[model samples]
Target: MRLFSLTILLAAVTALAGCNFKSVPEPQVSARDAEWLAQVPKAEEDIRYARYLMDDETGETPGTIVVDTKQRFLYYVLPDRKMIRYGVTVGDEAYGWTGTSRVARKAEWPNWNPPAEMKARWPHVHPMQGGPANPLGARALYLYEGNKDTLYRIHGTNEPEKIGLAVSSGCIRMRNIDVIDLYNRVDLNAKVIVR
Candidate 1:
């Protein structure tokens, strides 16, 4: 009887030790987020939008990002006159912007707070928490002119079907996998020229 009681105590102690008392509770996911997640397609990219390494025609220095809205491509200049090109989705004609800006910051799986203009345009728009369903996809490079944020981002998109199209409000959108690759390569405050 004494040995059995000791064995039971040992088992109880082992079970208690395996439990995590300080673990944080998971946040509740909203219905909208669930709906968005359901829409995520497989990560297959179209041949036209596939990443390619090609000659740098923009003549920008190494580590510069050149965005050609007309062709719907973003080029990351490399050393030795080489560039990595990735197809992207640019703003529609009425919402397009062209200027030189710096990547002020970057985020992985970033939470999205719709800009005032965007909110006004779409009354149903709401802030979304970061996750697989988030429209910002896997990464984001925030654009800024000096210290002021232009509210523009080069970010991953959930809608891979929109690549190589002019459809966003004024942001540059890339496939999630492509943006993840770009985010890993680019540094903060890198030069970005959108034309």
Candidate 2:
């Protein structure tokens, strides 16, 4: 009878010990990614848009890009449940698009071709050549849906002040340097999720 009572006590203690043990939280970001982010110039004079590390449990595989419009953040999922987050400027509610797409094409110093509707709204504006002054500042990743051009882009912006704000026409905008970094890391046909 005493042996049975001792076994019961030992089992209860072991169960309690197991319940108290906690698993270590996985790292959010990597040092190399953070170093790259540090090189990007601040969007504003006193306001810097610093990329961060975060624990991502979203089940997205590495190399996937996820845009959280509400937070003005773009996350690149990394191996081992980590994410490298970047600040982004999202489109306003009226022009915002939320869907999944793939990067169909990429270009450096991409030109700006104002849509016909935009041309009508601003008659003086014309298709601008790719340069520092162009709206597509330094790099452009053309987003496509099933081989069809969506006319939406994830590109750099000359107007760095717009970062972290809802001020784009209908695209994801990043700073020139940051966009260049992203351009180098992302591959053609990379999955992009905008939400």
Candidate of highest TM-score: 1
Please give the range of 10 consecutive residues that has the lowest summed lDDT in model 1: 20-29
For residue 164, what is the lDDT in candidate 2?
A: 90
lDDT by residue (tens digit), candidate 1, 1-195: 999999988987676456421211222434754455456776556655677777778999999999999999999898998888899999999899999999999997799999999999999989998877778876799999999999999998988889999999989999776787788789899999999
lDDT tens string, model 2, 68-142? Answer: 999888887878888767788999998899999999999977789988867886799898887667788778999
Model 2, residue 25: what's the lDDT?
A: 31
Q: Candidate 1 has which clashing residue pairs, if any?
A: none
What is each predicted model's overall lDDT from 0 to 1? 0.84, 0.78
Per-candidate TM-scores read 0.79, 0.75
Candidate 1: where is the Cα deviation over 4 Å? 1-39
Candidate 2: Cα lDDT at 73: 83
Cα shift from native, residue 160, model 1 (Å): 0.4
